[model samples]
Target chain A: MKRYNVGIVGATGLVGRKILEILVERDFPIQNLFLFASSRSHGKVITCGPYSVSVEGLNDDSFKDKHLDFVLFSAGKEASHHYAPLAAEAGAIVVDNSSCWRMDPDVPLVVAEVNPEDAFKHQGIIANPNCSTIQSVLPLKGILDKYGLDRVSYTTYQAVSGAGIKGIEDLKEQKQAHFPHHIHKNILPHIDAFDEDGYTFEEKKMIEETRKILHLPNLKVTATTVRVPIENTHAIAINASLSKPFELNELETVLEAYQGLQIIKPYPTSEMADGQDDVLIGRIRKDPTLPNSVHIWCVADNIRKGAATNTVQIAELFL
Target chain B: MKRYNVGIVGATGLVGRKILEILVERDFPIQNLFLFASSRSHGKVITCGPYSVSVEGLNDDSFKDKHLDFVLFSAGKEASHHYAPLAAEAGAIVVDNSSCWRMDPDVPLVVAEVNPEDAFKHQGIIANPNCSTIQSVLPLKGILDKYGLDRVSYTTYQAVSGAGIKGIEDLKEQKQAHFPHHIHKNILPHIDAFDEDGYTFEEKKMIEETRKILHLPNLKVTATTVRVPIENTHAIAINASLSKPFELNELETVLEAYQGLQIIKPYPTSEMADGQDDVLIGRIRKDPTLPNSVHIWCVADNIRKGAATNTVQIAELFL
Candidate 1:
């Protein structure tokens, strides 16, 4: 195995931290590691493989003249827009965990298991799909490959952590003060920033990314994205109307035998899917309204499969 | 105002308790009050209108002798199946909160604000739609009526209370133990029992009830229902594609002028909808894939609009 030099941009954020944890847990071959953060975190130290490395402040100079094998970018869109290209220009293949370049014509949106082959065609940068989209389509890919999909109608119960560390802190602070309002006990209707068009940024990603990744620009995709108080996993209730009729047994066979998709046979409960790495799928049945439509319940650790795990998996494919 | 004699079935459950509180708070004009429960709660006392009444054990004879004006059935389906007919046959109009009568051809599914007139023509019983369905459609009723609905794809983040008192207690117990699994921090895939067909009953209700209430037997409706750790509200992400092309302004106008739907237009966060009584609608926009499609985020206190509040409002129609 050839060990590679790696760096994580936005090292202090939620997804960045999880990527570090996963790299160590999965024991990926790492010859050298670097951590980058904003100016405020410049001198902080983080543990990586028996050594404590000081976090370097991010700037265009941070990537100047450095020969890096891979750079995992988990910062917000603005930072990625300003920094990802600099790192890529320095000969590092940037795997961005942001929406900055996802829909760009030149950038390839890759879900390792679903489209690892697409990585070889990346134009210096590869983009990870939205957390909700990543977890949602993982289970559907194999099924969709076998039976053509005409439309998808999905509702998401997304965790706050998908918005990063601040989101988690907001819910925690709200919970502790008994803030006269029940924060954790209620489901929030909003997730990310609301656009002038009224859909949150999160909902828009589901609409746009699903089409691009599936290579079906004309496929009907609609989403309602919401932020609930949960801190870890994101779950989706999918009512997929198919172009071809599929037997329940055939659908289960397709899901069960598929790689990267875990079928929780009887019915997938959130408690059962919590902390699991693979996309947990259950409650497969035919939709009565349409002749070939089917309904499925999907759950995945949003921080893992939705972000970190997918990034690491992409890195693995590069190796 | 004409005061109607009213009785409550399954008066010890969570929704049943909420109904009692709302009725008292609203000062509904009740000519007489009767509370019925199972044998386990027969001796319990519940106060109604400055009077303390003992709960009588439910039996065939419970409604056989009383000339009741109206009865609100909040018991489970089995109880409703056995007792709802008995009450109706005895000449007492029944507003059933259980799923038993919801899909019956003779019963009319009513959402007071959406289809209050449907209650007047009830053959014997008026059925309340599922909590998830009630909240999702209240905002869309006027829009769908004006523009016409082509299809609906909905996913629900339902509260544990929708499962009754035991479900709420289960999550509370799980949370107190600080069990490796934090109930509040996780999402559970299962909301109700899996039937032989593999679809949870809650998912089925979302599909069936929407069709019946909208009178769109052929309308494409797909639902994924999950039970979250929250105690009160149920939130849904609804992606509705309309039959006709309508602008965002027209949709907003329909929502703003619609009865029972409250538009939480700016930053419609869950924090805003908690403890509120009306169905909160926000995050409305056009679906990029289909020109006529629209996406919406809706939230409502499940124990209120989903159950108790709706039941009490039904009684108000008679008063």
Candidate 2:
């Protein structure tokens, strides 16, 4: 078996740490592991398999000495925007876990299960879709394939973990550090910054990245992204209008058969998807008002399937 | 002003307590207040207006000599089923907050602001719509009145208080006493019992009660009700398709002018609605995919506007 040297940018962050754990759990063939983060996390020691790697602060020349096969970036968009290109230019394929490169025409926004072929189309940078969008599109992809999707509307119950470490702390400490309001026992209907059209940036990502990943540029999509007080996992209520009619059982079968998905009978809650890799789907039913529309409840570990595990899966496609 | 004798059944429960607070807050014209509860709560003292009242256990002869003008029932359906009619027969008009009388053909389900006229048409018992339904209809009524509503879809972020005292305890103690699953730091997509068609009883209540309250019996409506870890407020994402196109500002004006509705611009979250009587409306935007359709975010204190305040408002109609 061939081994490769790999680098994880933003190693001390939530998604970055999960990437390290997943890489070890999946036993990715790595001859050398490099960890990089902001200066605040410099010298922090993180263990990966038999290697004890210290987090190094990223500089313009950080990736120059590392003969990296893959570099997973979970740093914020600013860090990715600054250093991801530098790492990519230094001869490594960058799998970015930020919104910076997602809509870039040259960058491939890849969900490993839904669009691995798109991963191969990457021009040195592969962008992972937003956590909520990642879980949503898996079920949507199956429906779009069999029934043909005309329109989709989403109402998300997103966990604090999606906002990163401070988000989790905000819920734990009952503080409003990362959110606009106290999220301990409240629900924030706003996720990312608002766009001029009243849609948040997070909603826009779900709308645009979903269209781009499905290769359906004009598929109609709208989203209401909300932050709930949960610690992990996000539950999205997806209402989609299909171009073709489908029986409830037929629709269930298609989703169950889809790769990287699970059907939890009756209903799926956030607890069911906590720490799970597969997107947990349940509450499948017809939207009686529309001719061929259905409502689906989807849940998944946002940090895993939504970020870390997805980026790792994308990197595994090359193996 | 003529003061009237008022009787309250289930005088110790969550909504029952809120009703007490609202009555005192509103300074309703009350001559004498009577409190009744199950045998477990018998002999408990409750202060109402200028009198200290003791809760009496309900029996066949409970209301025989009271000459009660109005009775509000917030007890469970079984208790309301047996006690409400007895009170009504004793010359008292009963306003029931249970599901038992909501769908009864003879009973009129009412949201105080939206359909006060129906309150007078009640023969003896008037029904209070479900907490979620009460808040949703206030805005939907505005839309239906201005631009005919063709279809409506709802995704609810409901608080634990909607489940009454036990539901609140479950979240505080990290237990699942009332809900089927753990709700602390979690989201449960299932609320109430599931029907054969996969809709929970709570979802059905939202769908049925909404149509009834709006007097649009043939209106197409669907709902997905989920329980979040919040303590007080319920927020709903309402997507409606209208029969006619609407300018954004025009729709805002219509909703703003609607009684009992408040437009909280940018966003209306659970915190914004907590402890408030008005239904807070926000995040109004066009659903770009569908013509003549828009999205609305609705939030309110489920215990207040959703239950207690609404029932009290109905009582005020007779005053």
Candidate 3:
């Protein structure tokens, strides 16, 4: 196996930390590693496989003259916008985990298992879809290719960690004090920062990223993103009104045939979705209200399929 | 105030215990009180206003020869079907919190604030809509009455308590143990036992009860019920595609004018919903994807508005 010298940008954030954890766990061959964060986090230590690396402030000179194989970017869009091109120009394949370039015509939005071949076609940077979109699409991609998808209507039960460390800390503090209020016992409608259009950034990402990845600009997609107190996985209740009808048994067969997907028939319980790499799917049945429509419940670890695993998978394809 | 003698059936169940809790907290005037449950829970001490009442084994003769004013039944449907009619025949008004009588033409399905007057037309028993349906409709009832609601598409992030004590205990046990698997971290598609039609009992209740309560049999209502690890509140992401267009400011005005709702605009955090009695509405916006559609986020304690408080309020109407 060819060893790659990889660097992780925004190594202090939740997703960034998870990327480091997954790379070590998955035994990704790394020749050397670099950690970059903001100025305040400079000199902080991040332990990867067998190396204790110190974080350095992100700067234009950070990637200027290094022989870098791939750079995994998990910072917010602004940082990715400013740094990803710089890393690419310095001779590194950039696998960005931000929404920055997902909808850009030139960037390939790749889910490794779904579209690993899309990696070779990337001009300089590849975009990882939003965490919610990545998990939902992983199971649907193969099925849609085989059966053809028409319309997708979904609502998400997302964890606070998707917002980064602040979200998880907010929920933790609220839980510890039994703060007259509770984050776990309630649901927050807004997932990310609000925009002028009223849709939270998270909701917009689901819409735009799904359209871009599926190559269905005109696909009928409606989403409502909500943040719950869950810490790991993101769950979705989806009602997909398809263009063609098939028996529930046949649909099950199609979903079961897909690799890296778990068919949690009987009923998809949250317990079933926890700690598993595969997307757990269940509650599969035909919608009684609409012809050719099917309803399914999907759950995946947001930190994995939504971030680290997908990023590492993209990096693996480059190797 | 005229005091009414009340009997609580299924006294040990989740909603049953909540019903007892609210009755004491609200200071409902009671002439005499009786607790009834299955033989398994018979003789269990249940604390009600200033007294620890022993639960009696339920039998056909439990309500016989007694002048009971109201009987709140939170028992399963089979139990409710067998005993509610018996209590009603014994001259007691039954406020059944089961689906058995919800669609019965002779039974009035009531939400006190939404349609208290409907209570006067009840023959012998009244039906309480499903918890998810109750919370969604209470806020919409006044708006629909004033603005005319054409359709609603709602997805619920339901609490485990909706299933009962066992469901709550299952999640708690799963959370306490650090197994190789993560039980509390994922979303569970199944809430209740599956029926012949493949829909969980909870999903069926949302579909049937919402139609009957709204008095719009043909109203376009689609529901995906998911059980999260939360213990109390049931939260919903509601998108109502109306026949008439309404501006965001005007719709906020309509929601603010309602009596039982608390608008948590700016950002509707999950912490805002815990332990609160009022339905928390926020993330209000116009649906940009469709014409004449609006979306809003709603949350309320499932034990209260979903079951107990509604049951107690119905009993209060007769008092």
Best model per lDDT = 2
Interface RMSD for each of the candidates? 2.7, 0.9, 2.5
Model 1: residue B99 alpha-carbon error in angstroms: 2.2
DockQ of each: 0.54, 0.87, 0.53
- Which residue pairs overlap in candidate 1's backbone? A188-B270, A189-B270, A269-B189, A270-B187, A270-B188, A270-B189
User: What DockQ would you assign to candidate 3?
Assistant: 0.53
Better of 1 and 2 by lDDT: 2
Q: Report how far residue B237 has shifted in candidate 2, in Å.
A: 0.5
DockQ of 1: 0.54
Q: Interface RMSD value for candidate 1, one decimal?
A: 2.7
Candidate 3, residues B1-319, lDDT tens digits: the string is 6888889999988889888888888998887889999999888998866858899999999998769989999998999999999999999999999888998989999887788888888888999888888889876776687677766767788777777786667677765332223335556665566888678777777777767777778876666777776776788888787667777788788788887787886645545565566788887877765557777788888778888889888888877
Q: How far out, in Å, is residue B167 in model 2? A: 0.5
Candidate 1 off by > 4 Å: A64-66, A175-183, A217-219, A241-243, A288-292, B64-66, B89-91, B175-183, B267-277, B288-291
Q: Over the stretch A38-88, how does candidate 2's per-residue lDDT look in tens digits?
A: 888889898867779999988888999789889999999999999999888
- For residue B36, what is the lDDT in candidate 1? 90
List, residue by residue over A1-319, the lDDT tens digit for candidate 1: 8988889999988899888988988888888888999999998998855657789999889987667889999988999999999999998999999999999989999887787888888878999999999988876687679988888866787777787776776677765332223446666555667677776678779878988888887888867776677776888877787778788888888888878788877655565655667888887878775558788878888889899999999988978
Per-residue C-alpha lDDT of model 2 across residues B199-309, encoded as one tens digit per residue: 999999999888888888999999999989988999999999999999999999999999989999898778778899999999999998888989999999999998899
Please give the distance, in angstroms, between residue B31's alpha carbon in candidate 3 and its true position after superposition: 3.0
Model 1: TM-score for chain B? 0.93
lDDT of 3: 0.80
For each candidate, give its TM-score against the true structure.
0.89, 0.99, 0.88
